[model samples]
Target: MDEEQITAAAYNDRSSYAKNRNKKRKSAGNRFLQNAKGFGRKHSFGRGAELEQEEYNYFLEILEALNGMTGDDTEERSTMANNVYAQIRDKEIKACSNQLSSRVLDNLLGFTDEETLQHVMTVFGENFRVVCCDKFASHVLQKTLFIAVLRCIGEMQVDEDKDASECRKKRKSDVGREMDYNLVMDFSPGHRRVCGKFVKKVAKFLLNNLEEFVWDSFGNYVIRQCVSNLAGITELKIGKGNSAEIRKLIVPDKWFKLINEFCSRLLVWPQFPEFPYNEFTSVLLQNILTSLDQTQDKFQMLQIGEKLLNDSFLLKDPEQDQSDERQKLPKVFHRDSSIRLLEVLVSVADPNFFKDQLYKRLFQGNVLLLSQTRATNFSVQKFLDCVSDKHILEHFFSELEVGLEEILQLGHTGVVASLAKACSRLACQQGKFVKLLLEALHCSDATGVKLLTPVLNLMPPEKQSSVQIHLHGSLILQAILDFNKPIKLVTAILETKNDQLAKVFTDPKGSFIVNAFIASKFVGEKSREKLIRHMEGCYMDLALSSHGSRVLELLYESAGSSQKEAIVRELSERVAQLNSKPWGVIINRKLRVEAYRQNPSQWKNSSKAIGGQRAEKIFDDIVDTGSQSKKRK
Candidate 1:
C-alpha cells in the first residue's frame, strides 16, 4: 500500500500489459492484411498503402454496420471495432491526415446500409468540431457533411417495421392512410428539423468562410437544392417563414437563373423518376414561380416566362402521328404554372418582351390549347386587356389568326370558330382583332363556318355588317352555296341579318345573295319568295335573268288562288318594262311557236300568229314540198 510498493507492483504488471497489447496489435494487423487482400481484388493499391489500408477497412466496416449487416467474421469485425474505438480516443488527431475528402464522403454516401451510415456519422460528429475549425476543412468537409445529412434525411424512417405493415395494409385495405404517410414522410417535422439544422450550418459556413466558393463555384447548385428542399419543407408546415429564410439566402436574380437552369436540364430527360435531382428541380422551379418579385428583376421575370414556354412545349403530347408507338398521352395544360409565370412577366417585363419569340410561342401554344368551355377564355380575355401596346396587341391577334388558320386547315372548325369568338372579345376597340375575326369567318372551312355561327351571332350589330360581307366573298361561302343542301346554308345565313351580305349580292362581283336565290328556287316557293324579297332591294340584274324565270316557275307551282293574282300582276309589270328589241323579238317568236303547237289548223289560217308573210311562205313551202312526194307514193 505504500507508494514504493505500489510502484514496484505496477512495474511487475507492465510486461503482462505489454504482452496483451502486442497480441491485440498483431491480431488487428493480421485482420487488416486479410481485408487488404479482399480490397486488392476489387481495387488497385499504391506504395505504403498498408498503413492507409486500415482507414479503408474501417470505412467498409462502418458501411456494413450502417447497412444493418452484422456477422460472425470475428477477426475482421474485431478489427473494425478496435479502429472505431481508437478514432474516438484520438478524436483530436487527424485519422488519415487528409481530412474526410469529398471522394471519401461520396463513397460513404453511396452505401446502402444504415449501420455504416450511423458509424460514419458517429466518426464525423466526433472529429467534426476539430476538423470543421480548419479553413480547408470548412470547404470540402462541410459540403460533404451537408450532402450526407441530406441523403440521410431523405432516407430516414420514423418506424420502418410499422410502415412496412402499414404499406401492405395500404395496398390491400387503407389507401388513404398509405397516401398520407407517403406525403408526410417526405416532409415530417423530424426530417425537416434534421435537414434544416444541417442546411443552416452549411449555409452559414458558406456565408462565413466559403463565400467565394459559393459565389463562384457551387453557388448555383447549392442555392437550388436548398430552395427546393425549403419548398418541400414549407409544404409540410414544418417551420415558420422558411420561404422567407430561403429568399433571404439567395439573390433574386440568381435564384431565378438557377430555376431556369434546372428547368432547362429537366427537359433533357423524358421521364422524371423519384430521384432527389428530379424532385429538387421540380420543387425549386415551383417555389421560384410562387415567390418571384416582379418589381426587382424584370429580366428574371422574362426568363421565367421563357422557361414556362419551354416547359409547356416540352410537356405537350408529341405531335400526333398514326405510326407513333406510344399511346396517346393526356395534354398537360399546366395552367397554374403557366399563368403564374405569365402574370409576373406581364407586370415586370418590358412591353417589347411580350413580343419576344418565347412569349409568342407560349401565348399561341397553350393559350390556344384552352377548351372553348372553360375559364381559359376569360383568362385570355383578361390577358389581352392588361396588355397596352397596340403593336403587341396586333401581334397577339396575328398569332391567333395563324392558329385559327391551322385549326381550319386541320378541319377543327369548332376550335377555329371559338377562337374567332375569343378574338372578338379582345378589347372592343381593337379593330384589328375584329377585322381578323371577320376574315377568319370568311375563309373558314365548313366546320369553321358552322363553328363561327355563334361567334357571328354574338358580334355587335354594327360589326356584323362588315363581317357578313367578308363571309359572302369568301370561297368557303361559295362552297356552301354550291353544296345544294339549301337548309344548312339558309339556316347559317338567316341567323344573322348581315347588311354586308346585301352589298355583296349587289356588288356585281359577289354572288352570295344571287346564289342563295337560285338555291331557294329548288328549296320551295316560300323560300324562293323570301330570297327574292331579300334580293329585290339590291339585285335588279339577278331578278331579270333566267333566275327570275325560275322564280316565276316556283310562283306558278305554289301560288294560292289569292297569291296567283299578286304574282300575275308582278310578272305583268316586270314584262311591260322589258323593252329591249332583241328581247321583244325573242318573246314574240316563243308565243307563235306555242300557238302553232297548240292548234295546227288554226295556225295554218292565221298569218299574224306565225309572223306575217315570211312565216306563211316558209310553212307553205314545207307543206307543199312534202305533199307532192308523199301523194305520188
Candidate 2:
C-alpha cells in the first residue's frame, strides 16, 4: 500500500501542479495591474494610443488626490481622497520613475496640505540621502524642501496670530466679564508635531553631508536649496542661534558647528582648483554673520571678519594718490562676497568686540580705501551708521581731504550718494561731522562741487528754467537742512544766479529736495518761512508740473494755515482749467481745504490729509463738477 499507493497518488496530483503554477501567474499579474493603475487603463489591440491618452491624464488623478488632502471639510470624500494618497505614496515608490516623481512632486508642492506635507516630510527624512543624491529624486527633494520651509514659516505665523489673538481675548475678558466666547487658541496638534521637525532634519542631513551634496550634479541643487533655506531662517528672529526657541531645538555647539563649517567653506573657496566659486556661499556667509549673536562666538567671528578684511583691497596712505594703491591691490575674485561680509560684520559688530585693532583697521587703516572702492563704499555707509566714535569721523575727514579728488574721480553715483547719506546720518548725532564735511567740501576747491555733481544731475530738465542744479546736491543739501545748522548752505544756494533755487521747485528731481527743505524741522523756522513764502509765490507754477505737483501736495500737508490757504486759493482759481493728473491732485487738495473749513470739528480727528477729512465732501464736489460740466455741454 505504501509504494504503489504513493506512486498512484503522486500521478493523480499532476493537474494540481499546473493549477498552482497558473494561480501564481495570476497573482503576479494582479500585482502588476495594481502598480500600473496610475498608468491608466489598458487597451486592447488597435487601442495603444487610447491607453497612452489615459496614462497622460494620470496627472489629473494625482491632482485629485492632492485636492482631497488640501480641500474642504467634506468628511465623506476626504476619507476616500486620503486612501488614494496612501496608495499613491506607498504603491508608487518603485514605479515612481523620474517622470512620475516630477508630476507627483509638482502637484503635491503646488497643493500642499498638512497631511500630504507630513507624508512628504516622513518620506524625505527616511530616504533623504538616496533622494537628494539621485538626479531625478533630487529635484523632488529640493522642491519638497522649499515647500516644507514655506509650511514651517506659515505655522510660525499661525502660532504668532494665535498668541496675538489670545492676548486680545484676555484683554477683552478683563474689561468685560459678561462676554462668553469659545476660541480656537491653538494650531492643529498634527502641525505642532511635524512643523519644526522637518526643518531641523533637513538642516542636519544637508549640513552633515554638505561636502558630498555640494559636488554632486543633482546634489548641488539640494545644497543650494539648503543654503537658501538657512539664509531665510537666519533672518528670522526665532531661527537665530541664541533665541530661546532655537536653543530648545538645537544645541549651541551644533549651531556653531553648522555656521563654522559654512564659514570655513568660504575661506577655502579660492583654494579649489577646478570648482568655480558661486555667490550662494557669499549669501550663506552674510546670513550666518548676521544670525550669530552670542558673545562667545564673537572671537571666532572676529577672526573670520578680519580674514575677509585682510583679503579685501585697502588703501594704505591717504596722502599718496590712490592710483598707485589701486594698482597695487590685486583684483579680487570675490569682491562682492568680501564687500558683503565686511558690511554684515560692521553692521552687527558689538562696540566692545570691535574696540581695538579691528576697529582701527576698519575706520583708519582701510577708511580711505572703503570710501573709494565702489562696492566697499556701499558697506561704508553701513559702517558709518553703526560707528558712534567722534574720532572715526575725524579720521574720515582727514583721509577724505587728501583723497577727495581721487574719490570723486571714481565717478560712481552710488558711492557719492552713500557718502552723503553716511555724512548726513553722522551729522544728526554730532554737529562736528557736518562742520567737517562742509569744511572739506569748501576746502576741495572744485572737487567739493564735483562731489555734489551727482546730486545736481538728479533734477529734471525744464523748458522755462534759466539755471539747472542737480538733485544729488539737494540730497546733500536736504540732509544738511534736516540735521545741520544749514543757514550758510541755504543762503549760498539761494544766492545762485539765474534763480537757481527757484528752479528747484519745478524740476522733477529737485522738487523732492524742495519738499524736504519745506518739511525740515532743522531748517531754521525763519529759513523755512522764507522758503515757504517763495513756494507760495510759485504755487501755480509748481501745481501745474508733473513731479512738482506731488511736491506741492506735500506742501499742502506740511504748509502752515496761511501757506495752505494761499495754495488752495491759487488752485481754486485754476481748478476749472486743470485737467492733467498733477493739476487734479492740486484741485483735490483744494477740496480738502474747503471741506475742513466747512466742518472743522468733523475734520479735526482725521490724521491723514487728502481723503481723511470729509470723504463725502470730496465725493459731492466730484459729482457737482461733473454735473456742471454736463450742463455746459
Candidate 3:
C-alpha cells in the first residue's frame, strides 16, 4: 500500500478506539455520580456541575501526581508543583471549593518553588477577597504574601548588588555602565518571573477594603501582614523606601479617611461591639504617622496632630479647613491608642508648629491631667520633649507655675521622673526657664515641698554619678545639679534642714548624689573636702553599705593626694574590717586601685597597700561572710 493510504487507515483505527474508551469512561462517571448523589434525588448537569466535577477530578489527579513527586530533588519537586498549579491556572473554582484551593495552596507553600510562587501571585490578584476570607485558604494566602514580599525585596536587592558590581567594574575598567542596562538581566527566566504588578494590585485592593478585614477575627492578621509588608512592595515601585509614607504612595484620600475613622473611634470610650486591639489597627496608625512625617503638607500634619493630641475625633470633612464641633474634651486619655498617636506626632510633626500651636492647646486642654493618670503619663512625657522653643518652654513652665499645686498633686514617682527629665532637657538650653521652674517649685505651698523634695532628694549630687534611687526623683535632681547656677540650687537644697545633703551621701536613694557631686568638674576642692569630712564619721559605715561604697570609691578616685591620703589612712585602719563586707571590699579595692594608678611604685613597694594577697583575702572574706550571713539568717 502507498505510505499516505496506510497512515490514514491507521489514524482512523486509533480515533475509533479513543471514542470507544471515552464512551465507556463517560458511562462509568455518570454511574458513579448517580450512586453518590442517590437515585431518588434529582440531579442535573446545570450550573457548570459537569465542568466542576471534571475540574475537581483533574485538580485531585494533579495533586495526586505531585504528592508522589515529593522526593529530595528540589528541581523535580518544583517541576511537579509548577505543573500542578499550571493545570488550575485561570480556571474558576466555586466558593464552595475553598478546601480544594487550600490544599493546592498548602502544597505550593510546601514547595515554595518560583513557578508555584508565580501561580500564587496570579491567584492572589484574581481571587483577592476569596483567598483572604477563607477559613483555611487565608493561611496559604498569608504565606504567599510573605513569600511575595520577600521575593520582591530580594529582586530589588539583586538589582542593588548588580549596581554595586557594575560600579566596581566601571572603576576597574574604562567606562561606567549605562543606566538603561537591565540590572536583573543576569537572573534566570524563572527568577525573573516575580509578579510585582500583580502584587501591587492585590495590595491596593486589600488596602482599599482594609476596614472590612482590619478588625476581622482572622482577617485582621492578614491585613496586618499586608499593611506592614506591602508597603515595601509599593516602595520598590515608587523608589521611595522608608522615607515615603504609605498614604502618599497608596490611595492617599482613602488612607486619610481610614486614619480619621480610627481616630474618631479612639475618641469614643469603650468601643462598641468590643473589638480586640489588633496589630492591623496599630500598624495602620503607625503608617498614618509615617505618612504625616514624610508628606510636605505641614498643615495636614498639624491638623491631625492637634486632633490626636486633643482627642477630638469628630468626623470633619477633609475639604473643610477646620471643624466647628465644640465637643467636651476627655479629662484623661484613658485609651491606650491615643498615647501612640501623640508619641508619633511629637516625634514626626513639625517641631515649630508643635511648640507654637499645639503647646498652648496642650496646656489649655488641661492635658497635664494626663500626668496624674498612669495610663497617659508617657504621652505627656513625649509632649514634653517637643517643647524646644525658648519662648514656649518659658510660657509652659510659667503656666505650669499657676497650677503647680495641681500639677504636683499628679506627681507619681514615674510622672515626676518624666517631668524631671523634661526639665533637664529644658535646663540644657533655657537656664532662665529652669530657674523659673525651680522658683515656682520653691514658692508652692507645703504640698510643693513634698512634691519637689522627691526630685531634689533623688538628684545625683554630681553629673556622672548613677543611683538606683527612684528614677523619677534621681533624674530631676540630676537635671537640677547640672544647671549653670547649680550652686544656687545646691545651697538651697542643702539648707532645707532636711539632711538632704547627708541623705544623698548616706542613704541608698541619695548616694548617687555624692558620686555626682564628687565627679562634678565645677565642684571646688573645699566642697570636695567638706563632702569627705561629712562621710568621715560614717566612713566605715558608708564603706560597708552597697550604695555608700560607690560614694567612697568616687571620693577616692576624685580626691586630691592629701584628701586621698586622708581617705586611705582612715580606711587603712578599717581595711581588715572591710574584708568581711561586700561593700567594704569594693571600697578597699577602689582605694588601692586609685592609689596604685596614681603611684604604681608606691603601691607595689608599700607593705600596707592592699594588693595581691590582701585583695584576695578581702574577696575570700566576702564569700565567707556572705555564706555565714546566709546561715545566720
Q: Could you give the C-alpha RMSD of every candidate to the true structure, in order shown?
A: 36.2, 21.6, 23.1
lDDT of 2 by residue, 389-441 (tens): 65665665566556654664565334445455666666633355444444434
Taking all chains together, each candidate's TM-score versus the true structure is 0.26, 0.60, 0.47
> For candidate 1, what is the TM-score?
0.26
Return the lDDT, model 1, position 344. 41
lDDT of 3 by residue, 152-229 (tens): 444455455655644543331111111112222333445544644454565667656766776664576675555545
Candidate 1 stretches greater than 4 Å from native: 1-196, 209-211, 214-219, 233-399, 402-443, 446-633
User: Which of candidates 1 and 2 reaches a greater lDDT?
Assistant: 2
lDDT for 519 in candidate 1 is 47
Predicted candidate 3: what Cα RMSD to the true structure?
23.1
Q: Rank the candidates by TM-score, best first.
A: 2, 3, 1
lDDT per residue for candidate 1 within 156-202, as digits (tens), equals 43455335534443331111222233322334455445444554454
Residue 99, candidate 1: how far off, in angstroms? 18
The lDDT, on a scale of 0 to 1, for candidate 3 is 0.51
- Write down the TM-score for model 3: 0.47
**Runs of candidate 3 exceeding 4 Å displacement:** 1-209, 217-283, 290-327, 330-336, 360-362, 365-379, 412-423, 427-470, 492-557, 561-601, 604-633
Q: Which model is ahead, 1 or 3, in terms of TM-score?
A: 3
Q: State the TM-score for model 2.
A: 0.60
Clashing pairs in 3: 417-472, 459-477, 461-513, 461-517, 462-516, 462-517, 504-510
